[model samples]
Target: MDIQVVHRPGNSAAKLTLDAGESVTAEAGAMIAMSADVGITTTTHKRGSGSLTKTVKRWFAGESLFLNHFESRRAGSEVWLGTPLPGDMTSMTLQRESLIVQGGSFVACESGVEVGVGWQGFRTLLSGESLFWVKLQGTGKVLLNSFGAIYEQPVDGELIVDTGHIVAFNETLQFTLTKAGGSWLHSILGGEGLVCKFRGKGTVWCQSNNQRSFGTALTPTLRARSR
Candidate 1:
């Protein structure tokens, strides 16, 4: 299978090409278009699993409880996947490695990749992120979508990132939630709030824009419409 990203940094889409007997698993409602020969199956869990517990965990990770699996019955079949937000999409091939994705960043993955929920503890909840994150591990291509342009930051020692701007990161790094400023009050007053402090050796993928910031910017307009 081959994955191509179209339209680049803004309003990007993932076009996946599959050969006969190949399959891909994706977040529910991610399929925008597909070949007629491709078959889609919706299940509460991954392809062959039926554990409701996993479904509930995925919900906590800000993903659909049900997942969609697309299979190509014939050669040269293709599927287009998109995200709810207008932004960039990228793919990575994992060779027996694990990736920790922020909630709502996942787009799709090859059938060989295992998708599960990773608990980040109460500290993450206070940092304005979901306590549960999507964990992908295995040997296949995994696609991720961001709210804006995506960039990779390699961390050999430590790095500080705004909690709201993260897309995903390598599991080799350890992250802690801390104030952006020296104190919590100063952090809040500075409009930065909590930030993620990643320590260790790995790469962190971040979005150029923050989804919460975008929503906050439009709050007045939405309120005025309701009024």
Candidate 2:
């Protein structure tokens, strides 16, 4: 299968080309278009025959409870998939190790890639976001979507990223979530509330804008309009 991303940095969409009898799995409601030769099916079909329990885990992880599967009856059939968020979509090829993603940022993944929830300690509450992370394991192509431009940086030693701006990272990297500055007062006044300090060697992906912050900022205007 071949995938191409279009309308980058804004309303991005994915165009996938499939070989005969080949199949691809994606998040429900992500399909924008598909060729007539492609057959569509939806199921909680997790590998290893994991059925209901596996589907529940994916739901808790913020993915669709049932994944949409598209198969090509003839060679060279194509499909288009899109994200609900107006931002960038990124795709990565994964091996044995898993990629831990902010639950809402997951768009889809090819079959063979497992999706589950990673529970975090209460310490993550200080980050101003939920504690559950979508853990994507196995070997397949994973598509991640974000609320802004996606920037990827390779970390060798240590790196600091705004907690709300981080999209995903390699599970191999060790990270600590803490206040951004010296003290509580400084952290609160500095405008940078929480940051994730990542150590070891791996890649980190950050969004240019924080969707939560954007929503917070827009609430007032929306309320006024509603009134």
- Compare the candidates by lDDT and give the number of the best one: 1
lDDT of 1 by residue, 1-227 (tens): 99999998997998999999999999999999999889998898887755788789899889999889999998889999998988999999999999999989998999889998888888888877777899998999999999999999999999999999999999999999888998889999998999999999999999999988899999878746644
Q: State each candidate's clash count.
A: 0, 0
Q: How far in Å is the alpha carbon of 130 misplaced in model 1?
A: 2.0
TM-score of 1: 0.96
Q: Which pairs of residues have clashing backbones in candidate 1? A: none
Work out how many backbone clashes candidate 1 has: 0
lDDT (Cα) of model 1: 0.91
Cα deviation of 59, candidate 2, in Å: 3.2
Mark the 10 consecutive residues where model 1 has the least summed lDDT.
Answer: 218-227
Q: What are the lDDT scores of the predictions, listed in order? A: 0.91, 0.84
Tens-digit lDDT track of model 2 for 29-75:
98999898798887885534456866776676567787778888988
Model 1: how far residue 182 lies from native, Å? 1.1
